[model samples]
Target: MREVRATDLPHIREIYNYYVANSTVTFDEDAMTLAEWRDKFYYLNKQGMPFIVAVSPAGQILGYALVSPWKQKKAFRFTVENSIYLGAASTGKGLGRELLGELIKRSKAAGLKEIIAVIADQGADASIKLHRDFGFDEIGRMGKVGFKFERWLGTILLQKSLK
Candidate 1:
């Protein structure tokens, strides 16, 4: 795993677009363009957030993890939100665990008070378990809070207190 760079946008976009188009991993139904992703990278950089990518020794981008502001309010500065996406082929390969672990560690090091994960209910069991394993407690669950693919989806808000 390494820090994601501007040149990594294509591979990152490809991995994310796969999730956006075919999976419920992200609520976004439309594929993101390179410009949009570049803007995201820029925003994260400006916010001093971490954008991490897992790549093979051969330079293949397999997955990415990011920690971004949970809310823009100054009062919420100590809290951050995290997301990790692994390519279909990278699943079950320990990539998600490593990536998320790094993300949490970096987040805490960056002086964030808490880390929040808003996970979709269906494909969330493993992710929730992962968070729990890392000491993130289940704070709340918002039932039917989102809709995608013509169906209602629930979101679980998990939290890890860094303080």
Candidate 2:
């Protein structure tokens, strides 16, 4: 695992677009263009957030994870929200766990004191389990807060302390 590079954007976009087109994991109604994808990272980079990707022995990106400000205000600087995406071919092989492990490690190293996860209520059991397995606890749930895939979707909030 390592920090994401400019070249990794294409693979990251590919993995993200797959879900945008076929899943409700992301609430984005449409796929982002290459330029938009580039823009997505600009703010995070400016905020000194960590965006990392896991690679295979041959160097193919297996998955990616990132942290963003839980809130942009100064008072929220101690916390971050995380997002993880795995290539279609990468799931079920512990790639997500490895990527997330790296993300959590980096977050702590960066002095972040808390990590929050916002997971889709449906089709995210594994994600919930992953967070819980790493010591996050379910803090709350927002029912039907997001509309996606022609239906209202809920979000589950989980939190973990870094210190």
Candidate 3:
């Protein structure tokens, strides 16, 4: 695992778009464009946040993890929301655990005080368990807040304090 580079966005987009198209892991009903991913990369870079990627020996991006401002308000500067995505072939191989662990460590070093995870309630049991394993606690849940794939969905909010 290492810091993400601009050239990795395409692979990152592919991994993320797969989830957008095939699963409820993300509520995005449409695939994100490469330009959007670029914008996100720049935003994270400017904020001095961590955006990490796991690559294979051949230099193929297998997964990525990142933290962004939870809210734009000044008072929320120390808190950020985290996102992690692995390629279809990379799951269940302990990559998520390593990526998340690295993400938390980097986030803390970046001076972030809190990390929040807003996870989709459907088809995201693994994510919930992963966060719990890392000491993130369930803060709350919002039901029927999202409508996607012709169904109602909710979110589970988990939080961890770095201080």
Candidate 4:
């Protein structure tokens, strides 16, 4: 894994777009342009957030993990919301564990005291378990909070304290 570079956005976007188009991993119903995606990452990087990509030995991006503000208010400054995405072919390979672990390490280094993961109720059992294995506790489950694909999807909120 390594810090995300500007050149890495295309590959990263590709991985994300696959899920956006075909999976319930995210609630995003539409795909974003490369420029918009680049700007999004730029803002996070500018704010000193860590956006990392896991690359194969041949340098292909296999997955990515990032940390962003949990909330806009200053009182929430010491906590962050995390996101991790991998290529469809990359799941179940233990890459998610390594990627999340790295995000936690970087979050702690950034002086973050809390990490929040909001996982979808559908198709995220593995993710919830992954967070649990890494010491995050499920604080709550929001019932039918989001609608996608003609269905209501709930969210599980998990928290991990770096302190």
Candidate 5:
């Protein structure tokens, strides 16, 4: 895992947009703009948070993992939410495991007390399994909490205690 750079935004956007447009893994409705993503890059980098990319030796971005504040409250400061995405052709290569493991390590090192995952009901077994493998436990299930693609989507909350 390596720190993502500004130049890596294109591939990151591509990877994320794929999930947004094609999968229920993320709740995002549209592809983020380059400018919007730049702000993200700056925020995570400046905050010393992990914005990790899994790259091939040849430098192609294969997957990425990251964490953000679980909530915008001071009481929630030690908790963070995690996200991971692999390139379309990069699935089943163990990159998600490597990336998520690194994310857990980095988040704990940053003084986080917990890692939370908000997973969509559909297309989330792999992600749920990945988080479970990393020790995240299911906490709640909200039924039909989201509407996308002409259907209601459920949300599963999973958390791993970092303390």
Candidate 6:
């Protein structure tokens, strides 16, 4: 795993867009464009947040992990929302664990105080377990807050303190 570079955005976009198109892992109903991805990368880069990627020996981007401001308000500056996505072919190989672990380490180094995970209730059991295994506590849940793929969906909120 290594710090993400500008050139990695395309692969990152591809990895995230897969979930947007095929899974409820992300609530985004449409695929994000490369421009949007660039904006996000710059935003996080400007905020001094962590955006990491795991690459294969062949230089393929296997997955990515990042943290963004949890809210726009200045008071929420110390807290951030975490996101991790792996390519479909890269799952079940402990890459998620490595990415998430590195993300937390970098987040703490960035002086972030808290990391929040908003996970979809369905088709995200591995994500929930991943956060729990890292000591993230279940804060709450909201049911039927999202509608996608012809059904109502919900979210599970998990949090971990860097302090």
Model 5 RMSD in angstroms: 0.9
Q: Model 4, range 35-66, lDDT digits (tens) per residue?
A: 98789888998778888999999999999999
TM-score of each: 0.96, 0.96, 0.99, 0.97, 0.97, 0.99
Candidate 6 per-residue C-alpha lDDT over 43-146 given as tens digits, one digit per residue, 9 for 90 to 100: 99999999999999999999999999999999999999999999999999999999999999999999999999999999999999999999999999999999
Query: What is candidate 5's lDDT per residue for 77-163, written digit by digit as tens?
Result: 788888899999999989999999888888888888888899998878988998898888999999998888888999999999988
Better of 2 and 6 by TM-score: 6
Worst 10 residues of 4 by lDDT: 16-25
Off by over 4 Å in 4: none
RMSD (Cα, Å) of model 1: 1.0
What is the C-alpha RMSD, rounded to one decimal, of candidate 3? 0.5
For candidate 1, the per-residue lDDT at 75 reads 99
What's the residue-level lDDT of 145 in candidate 4?
A: 85
lDDT of each: 0.89, 0.91, 0.97, 0.91, 0.90, 0.97
Clashing pairs in 3: none
Clashes of 3: 0
Give me the displacement of residue 37 in model 5, in angstroms: 0.7
Alpha-carbon runs more than 4 Å astray in model 6: none
